[model samples]
Target: MNQNVATSAPFLVFTDLDGSLMEHDSYSMEAAKPALAELARRGVTPIFASSKTAVEIIAVQRASAITAPFICENGAAVYDSSGKILTAFGLPRASWLDAVHQLRERLSLRFTGFSDWPAERIAELTGLSEGDAGRARSREFTEPMIWQDTQANFQLFQSEIQKLSLTTLEGGRFISIQSQFDKGYAMKWWQARHNQPRPFLVALGDGPNDVSLLAAADAAVVIKSGKSDQLDPQGPATVIRTSIPGPAGWNDGIRQILNLLDSQQLLIY
Candidate 1:
């Protein structure tokens, strides 16, 4: 792959991390190196939009050699390439926890979330190294929780959370408690913030939490996930799925999307 393949216009990529670019268990993005290299060469901006914390996203950014902006904590915050936060959507973690405390006592919604777990516990649960788990534990605007109640109770909890104006998302693993904005809102806000004309948006994700993002893109690719079953994004946006899993699937999806974009003269390399 040429490192000098420059694109005529910016190709905006808003991607998920865990099961899309990074391997589920190994947590490595080695297989996506080809596509990463190509995107870097073409100067196509790849921005991570995940449920990961800033430090976790930083680690991935370092490994992937990406210097563009990133959306963190399930779109609760957006940060620029220079590591500066561009925008924030929700209240701080402490405030949310305060609300959770109230809800827990009042409604008896049984749950265990990232905020309730220490770094060591989180490490054991997610198979991340201690340091990475520590970073993951350092959430800002959201809490990813596991419901420990019956179906009726869970539905009740979801309804009450909604009434509080908070959003509950069912991801591949945890049930995420987030701000009103999802990844799709973050993607759109990032695009709108760009001074350049609207770029062709391409998003790739593999989990159920990624549905909104896939739905928002001009071209969305759903990678095969090892941690979860395939998702059906019920949206009008052009969509595709890779047969392979993990970063191999990611590589295929990005390359294929680039070719399709090139054909439409929407991209150059």
Candidate 2:
């Protein structure tokens, strides 16, 4: 956590990375600078909750010149501003990979995950540079894959993995298999650690994987991503749907929330 921001700050923001804060195809966050700067100015902490790896999140933090805690691997782990693992909700990556291997052999599943491809291949698939792809491949908790099998086979695969105490998250671009946990679980853990009087929780995301996080927040921002499976959080949070997509939507959503908070005089500063 950044020491400049008080632990009892009035607001805490949780945001997903790809397709929410970053562009869906280009992975750029240029349009969100205004909102990000406003949060910084207001001493509000933004916690990144995403399916990205710790190193990938760290790289984003460094580039953005912000230091805050992050939830990675679809809520498998939480890391501090210094990229230190504060807590983990899942088992080791090797264990999940081994289970996947066994399931594939037994069920003849068809999928190519990060472990099955070289950094170059991953770069080709995700449009990431080779260096970024390598960072992404350094997984500690989950296996993100491109599911190439039939729908029936995929259903069977999910059933088989569930038997092993693992589950899948359908991210914007891949299906991630990991230990049974969601972003909401990790967010609650982070909040418990930081609570003084309990900050106003805000969350933003654009995929099914983000549903849990959105539901857990006091305010939910659903960014438009052109996907048919639009997220509809079933929680009691005040929901804000963005008309635009990506960081532009993210920017609008955050500003709108801040405006609401200001009007209510809920903001401390």
**Candidate No. with top lDDT:** 2
After TM-score superposition, the amount by which residue 123's alpha carbon in candidate 2 deviates from its true location, in angstroms, is 0.7
Q: Please give, for residues 1-269, the per-residue lDDT of candidate 2 as tens digits.
A: 24343576787889999999999878898999898888888887688999999999999888777788899999999988778899999988887688689779888878889999999999998999999999999998899999988999988988888888888888888989888888988998888876467767889999989999999987889998866147888873488999999999999999999898879834433
Q: If scored against the real structure, what TM-score would every candidate get? A: 0.90, 0.94
Candidate 2, residue 148: the lDDT equals: 89
Error of 1 at 174 (Å): 1.0
Clashing pairs in 1: none
| Tens-digit lDDT track of model 1 for 205-264 | 998888888888888899987533557776625788899888899999998988887697
Q: What CA RMSD would candidate 2 show?
A: 2.1
**Relative to the unseen true structure, what is the C-alpha lDDT of residue 18 in candidate 1, on a scale of 0 to 100?**
85
lDDT of each: 0.80, 0.86
Candidate 2 residue pairs in backbone clash? none
